[model samples]
Target: MGIVVDLNGKREPQPSLEALTRLVAADLKAVNELIVRRMHSPVALIPQLAGHIVAAGGKRLRPVLTLAASRLCGYTGTRHIALAACVEFIHTATLLHDDVVDRSELRRGLASANAVWGNKTSVLVGDFLFARSFELMVEDGSLEVLAILSRASSVIAEGEVAQLVTANDTETGETAYMDVIKAKTAQLFAAACQIGAIVADRPAVEKEALESYGMNLGIAFQLIDDVLDYSAKQAKLGKTVGDDFREGKITLPVILAFRRGSEAERAFWRRTLEDLDQKETDFDKAVGLMGRYQSLEDTIERARHYGAIARDALGIFADGAEKDALIELIDFSIHRAY
Candidate 1:
């Protein structure tokens, strides 16, 4: 989760939080410089489209995680900044393509890139960003970072394909859901933290521990995202409620609801999912049914489980403000805006 902690008086120090905010503030400038320089290049319309989306404000969670993890490992270097920017570039690229595929209208309270630019341009620009991210990673010159990010990007691509194939399939169980979330969300989180360790040249044990922490944190973060899709206000979410249902993306809450609902509820799930285009009332009824059954609570409990595991993973690190901040981050992911 990309959380900004208010570290006020009479409390333990928070090195990770402090470092993360500073890194974001600083490296965001670097990324913007790179974007503008590239925009002036004679690339295709796709690169131009990508530049627009990349400049749009987001929490910059992946890059922040990279910088924080490196600081927690006692790193003192400028390369971490460039590496963090690389992570954000890759993440932004993924979003441009994802919005195009999902046919989404809104993201981060703004019109989606694909909404303004055509799908072809969005996808092509996303590819340019991906290539640019690789160039930045190579500049960092850490073989481990390169390997970790490369594998993670591959896993993310596979996860998106899996999601498209499994959407609206009620037979999708918890195991399948876990696989999808781990690949799509957790992979990048794990890579973000692992790269931090690589940049710091930390021992193998500590690096692996941070990777575990990030993977659990990523899973928990996505779990909350899934819950919010059904529960949050449209303004807060920057998107419509039941948007996933309308798109036939059967997330954890919907899966739980399907398993626990009565026969009529089961039939309702089928009607909404199997039918090509469902009415607005159909989506509304599905939301009402899930609310009645407390399916959101079930999903939240699952998120809490992963959050606890992430916090526990931090125990391997020596007690410091950085570790304290990491623990609080887990809490933020669990209790966030639900």
Candidate 2:
């Protein structure tokens, strides 16, 4: 029931992002074309590197949200096409920057841009993408759209800063961590969905509903990401099992486990995470502690709670393929962690 059917016409346990993409296939094609067109520059490396990452596989979820939201609002114009491209540019820029900041060696199971071209090139290219995103926003010619996206860009930066401040603190509370995810990750999602309503000239209530759906969905998405880092296979998760642990990134499972563990467990987290004094065995120990506290499962349950909110936010809309796809996407996002 998660999806209609795959190309092979078999039942799928959940709706694939590919199925969602097919729902707005033509618009996604235009968005891809615009992505390549806008990334063009006289500087060869700018386009080359940008193309490499853009062509690298991604769900294009943010842009897809914009496109689907427009359709859900019953808009038929092509304006959403360019604006969808804008959302993508913003997302790509953030990925380029995140890989650099995390000092990551891999992305999407490939060498990270920074790893291949050095941190300077990666950072500059990220800046270039950000500038390109602004240009697309300007071209869209909607002051409201521009304002929402611009504020989202600033909020994303603030979220990154907040994460840096809270990193490896071992005392990062659920509230503070939620704030970081809301700002850094959810803000763009909220903006992306809201722009659809804006372009469709929908009223404030619908705009708020889509925004809420995006925000809650994003929280569910990131929470699952945190859980999968420890629980999912590398092939499934597309990153090392302990990347967060190695980087000392404080996420929900770690937050919950640390708070719920014994005194010795707290000292252990301090030794490995706060002190960055880790050995190969440390990851195993950390995993054991997380399991002992039921942290991973608990985190996924929290994600389900947010997923329910995301679904409810869309209740104002009648049942249809778009709404069903979005609801399925929420389930997909949460279950991907398992």
TM-score of each: 0.89, 0.95
In model 2, how large is the Cα lDDT of residue 64? 96
lDDT of 1 at 26: 62
The digit string of per-residue lDDT tens for model 2 on 124-230 reads: 99899888888888888888988999999999999999999998899889999999999988898888888889999999999999999999999999998889888
- Best lDDT goes to which candidate? 2
- Over 262-287, each residue of candidate 1 has an lDDT whose tens digit, in order, gives 99888888878856468768877887
Candidate 1 global lDDT: 0.78
Model 2: ten consecutive residues of lowest lDDT: 231-240
Tell me the deviation in Å of residue 114 in model 2: 0.5
